[model samples]
Target: MQIQDLPYPDPGVPDVRSGPRFLWWLGRNQLGGQLTSLAWGLLHFMAVSAQPFCVGFAIEAVIDRSGARLALAGGLMALFGAATALGDTFLHRTAVTNWITAAARVQQLLARKASQLGSALSRRVAAGEVVAVSTGDVEKIGWFVEGVSRFSAAALTVVFVCVGLVVYQPALGIVVALGVPVVAFAALPLLPRATRRADVQREKAGRATELASDTVAGLRVLRGIGGEELFLDRYRRASQEVRQAAVSSARMWSLISAIQVLLPGLLLIAVVFYGVHLAREGRISVGELVTVYSSVMVLMYPLRHFEEIAMAYSFSRPSAKRAARVLSLERATDAAGSRAADLPSGDLYDPATGLLAPAARLTAVVCGDPDAAGRLAERLGGHPSEDGPSVLLGGVPLDELPLEGARTAVLVQDKDPVLLSGSLRDLLDVPASGEVGPTEALAAAQCADVLDALVQGSLDAGSPMDAHITERGRSLSGGQRQRLALARSLFTDPEVLVLDEPTSAVDSHTEARIAEGLREIRTGRTTILFTSSPLLLDRADRVVLVHDGVAVAVGVHRELLHTEPRYRAVVTRETEEETARGGVLKELHALGDAERLGDNERQEIEESA
Candidate 1:
């Protein structure tokens, strides 16, 4: 099945209902396995109960002095032993199958939800919390779910054993039967405390995981600024908190375990004492007293199941809650009947900022605040947000389109694009299609040098572009990754492309080439370039200077530089500052060849009829 086809209902707002409902949903999905497990558990418990009866019968037969009776009792005991062993084995097998299947289903559901949400998933929930749910929480919930059948069978066995004893030897049987339930249930009071501790432990663990992930992702930057030690110190403190929380949780569980053992022992003692009193009074025979004791001993096994189920539930409840919280994140909603097909394909506009880009125009947006630009880029790409005016494409609201459709129609290439691990070819093969050839896309993004570098560093015995890239393209330089990202977007050939500072990482020459190539390749497509580079802005058909969330000026790049002092100052910071120790013109000229041979080759190609 495809990843999108996996079953994952939109879990609504979390309440007390969410955890129980999720469990119930899982049980319903695996009802057949659950029933099979329950049947086997009952059969297993019955076989176990019969062992005690066989032992008591053998004792009575020995007293009667009948060889035939003794032989029959011995045969019955051996038969019950084999039956009990087989039953227990099958029961455990069936129960474990149920546990694994249930966990797998929950994991599948969680994975599907994560994929559906895409980048939005981490925004709504901590990365660590999502990690914990998929890993630990799924197993805990499955354990509790499977334990239900075993505990039910155990409870039923205790009832039947009690009734049998009451019929055979009423006096001692009543106390033995009544005491089991009390001892098993006595641990309930501690469960709430245990669950609370478990929740706290899980919370702290998620925080520690988030810290670790963040530290690892920013490790290079941290080390570059000599802040690695500071982050390490913070992580160490967080790890200690997680350890303390885990210890606290473990202590509560230990207390519960002690009670599970102690209370059951107390009940066994009470049963033995009562059974002896009845035998002395001649209310029950010696063999029957043996039966009474054996039955109580057998009852201990089932009673243990009760305590185990309690513990399992205590641990799983909070885990289930955490899983539910992630599943419950709301997806962006569109108006009824407003499907992706209805979305228009002309100029994109943002009403909040009053910024309009005519169709097929190369528009440059200049914003003083980078954060505002980022937010605007998101909105322009149809990302859901509460604080912005709606973005429209050809007068149709962009938010009304389906996610996939909107993404295909309008691609947003962020400044720092995420690079997934794969071969160079695989890395550039996002949203996989064959519209843009590899060589052409590379040339368009001015990535020939980047490709050559990758080839030089290839460790595999294969074509360089086919060489495997590490996770997040960590093996490649930052500028190479960025250019590769630009190449990928250029390959997509989206009708409307929004690039946010796409050339921020590259050198001036490479940046200028990229800007020229981008304009040439996307000659007829509507492209929005968000950058402060004069080289890029100079090529744009129109440059819009945004101040305080509104577009204040719209004109050509050179016109804005001459007329709009704000736009000019924003772009040419070094040039405007008189106090700045500007480099000598001769020194600037030595930086690079002003008219490189590569530029001449590109210009010749452009002019070729």
Candidate 2:
């Protein structure tokens, strides 16, 4: 495909059977591009090789004292020069195009897989490994992909030159041809050692990346617990291990590079020594000797591609394997049951937890165990569990619906929903029913303060909606990020919106406002909030108190608080939860407010809280 046609309409289904198979599949898919590049490579290398022959002919013409033949030889040399320049330019263009398109295809496949797996991706793969695969591994795979066609052309050029030499002069030609194979395959024995070292380096690098990512994600927590040095030391050790592995890998590759250089140089020396002897004995003409020597020199150019091909394959093989492993991951819901023909429109019933969230109403579930609450949210969104049957909606199993269907029917926003880096408008621009606007969703999620912070923090002083958010929304406070995530979820306007502790980070006043806004915005739609805060529970149309993964009481917030002791205990404990936010959180919240407030005002807000 043309470069303009890239990012492809489809990357096509990949062969995840093995790494080598997947690499082969990528090459097969881009056969047209590869052929185009190969054609250019052939033209370029042929022109280059023909120049040495032209030079030899020029020497012969001069030695014969023929002026006309010399001019013709000069003209042919210029013609080959022009062809070489033209072919080289186009060859580079096509090769780069192949590389970029190959990388884009892999990126698309990885992104599609990540979407399919959702939160489960983190469970199956290390965050660092995923990051490494998507970034470093992609480039390596693309490098091998783009190099393959060039390597083929180079190999063909070497063979063509070898044959030309054998026909032109047999005595010296035979010697050169015999030496070519040895030079080409000289480093093959060391390749396994080099490849193994590269694999070790990649593995250690991935581990270091994962450790660094985890440490950064929990930096605040580590600092709070006075464990920052502990993690720092761990990360330091990981980084050192990565460095050591990289050094070891580099040594092996260096040895291979040395062998490649030394063997080719030795071949050149042997050719020169034998060619001089033949010329002195008058076995070949002066011009024929020049031609033979130049032919061997020109042959060295294509011979380098041999080592390059080996190196590219060594690095890309493991990278392709990692990408293949991730792509091979199947969503649990896919194998749970057969596809449901229609979207279910009714209560979400989890038989495992014995909980029912009626349709077209807001239901609040207060699960004592946070883990159980998360699992329930997962099941409600069609994530299968080996513990029990899949959740049902409208008497149809949720797992029976296709992944996209299930996602459309049920949207679950976990307690710590991630915020991808982008403009505020882009973050809210998700796949939705188009029933909710950004303004309304922001209002419903009580994100006015967040909007203000984003605008105030903008260095460009441009549109507030265009303000850039840092990766993971680190620029915003925990509460602000939470509200922003909630706003994004609200904007989707799904059939069923499951929010787990959506307002946990915000203060009680903000939480109460959010609870009321959620009730108003989610009216006439199925909404389930897994929260213990009385503020959120009071706003629910019906409340279910879950104990030990089962619904033990069902009533309004006030009714259950008075009638059920377990419910009362959970609700009262919310006060202690509020108080626990006083120590380090007080400082964190104060620092967040300090971005938009004066010191005295921030201090007052913190004191009042």
Candidate 3:
């Protein structure tokens, strides 16, 4: 079976039985490569085992003192050496290829699962956990899978050598065979303890990795709040805990290694002692005794694989479990059998809160809780929800529409919009098409000065539209990134554009210009601006003050200010305080009258001309 044909575990499924099963899954996917690797490993081990027999033959040939026998022994040695060299080379090449392919397959599976989960992945699993599983865990899993073929060949070599020894001389052969098992099985008792220690070590290492990732991502915020040292100290403590776990794991493995050396040496001694007795009793000939001794010595080599396989499994099982957990995260589900319906060109309704936004009219929602506002925006944009009322665009249920279709019709630009790396022009180019152009979008977003500033810095020296942006637009200021995000959203020109605190980052003057530009650019399109800014609110055709998640009052901004005290208190807090201070209110009232007069004059001039 090819890798493509292998059954990838479904992310929604929870049970994953064993490490060998996972390895078998990997092998089935790359059957041809695995077979080639296994064949090479068997040939390599066979070649290695042939060396001892050749040495034994040479020793016996010299004792015989025959020219033909010596020549035959020399010929066998040469053949064995050449074969061993060739087999070793091919074995290494195949083994490394197996390792790389296995790693790549796991990586491909992980990347595909991540994409399938989309935004829901981060919600289900921590970002640091995902990173750990992909990088460190995948490599360990590959290591275990590649070790399987090599270890199997080693065991086969040991078995074949023991049989050859017994066939030549039974008494000596029995001693050698029994000694081999003793050397290999001596390490079994300590393996369970070693494995447990290794598991603890790996878990601690994953935690340290997670803590470091979180620290780096939030470094700026931590420093801003004067908590850098606190987090640093916590990370240092985590690092120490990982160090302790590593030391404990090392101690267990070190004990295993000591036993691996000592038990094998004792077994070789017992075999040689027993073989000497057999020769004294004349039960085995001198040539047979030499072969028995040589085979016993060589059998020690394959016995080492017992320890290696134990260690590989000790590391791999926990790693596979970690990877499996990551792969098992379920993606968010949409309602079954819900189909997209035609949206009405009238009021949008939310059945849960019993709210409606009249056709082509500006509507404001004033929610007491900030989270409630965010949830409302998500519902308005047709994100899947279980508890809330279905949001209806026109009279059509928003959730019933296909994702792409709903997204095109209504866009909810969140408060903290992500700014991808790019120059001012590239940043403003949403959908990044050269057709809509950046000039108009930037002006509408009140980002003309931002573009000019970038141009002045030689940042826009090349084709402005093609200029590179850094990741997350980290190079730009917070307010600049915000406005650029706004510009990109405006470029999309969707039917119902929902802005959540769109003007929060900009100054009052720029905010006012953005409000005026929005009214002009989105003339007939339904737009909802979620903000308590008086400048933006006064420009709205209607305002809905949402208190306790319900739309309580709806009217023009000025009308709501007079009729609803809660609405007036919410929007006019600063103005009311200014009025108490005497001159500030007079200045604001004069500015408001000036803006009204300017609008009247512009209207009159347009009418006359």
**Please, what is the whole-model Cα lDDT of each candidate in the order they appear?**
0.78, 0.87, 0.73
**By the lDDT metric, which is better: model 2 or model 3?**
2
Clashing pairs in 2: none
* Model 1: residues with Cα > 4 Å off, grouped in runs: 1-17, 66-86, 335-343, 386-390, 546-552, 562-609
| TM-scores for the candidates | 0.85, 0.84, 0.75
Q: Which stretches of candidate 3 lie over 4 Å from their true place?
A: 1-24, 285-290, 334-435, 446-463, 466-468, 489-609
**TM-score top scorer:** 1
Question: lDDT of candidate 1 vs native?
Answer: 0.78
Give the lDDT of residue 209 in candidate 1: 85
Candidate 2 TM-score to native: 0.84
RMSD of candidate 1 to the truth, in angstroms, is 9.5
**What's model 1's TM-score?**
0.85
Q: For model 3, state the Cα shift of residue 302 in Å.
A: 3.9
Clashing pairs in 3: 3-29, 340-401, 344-394, 366-546, 421-469, 421-470, 422-469
Error of 3 at 274 (Å): 2.1
- Ordered list by lDDT, greatest first: 2, 1, 3
How many steric clashes does model 1 contain? 0
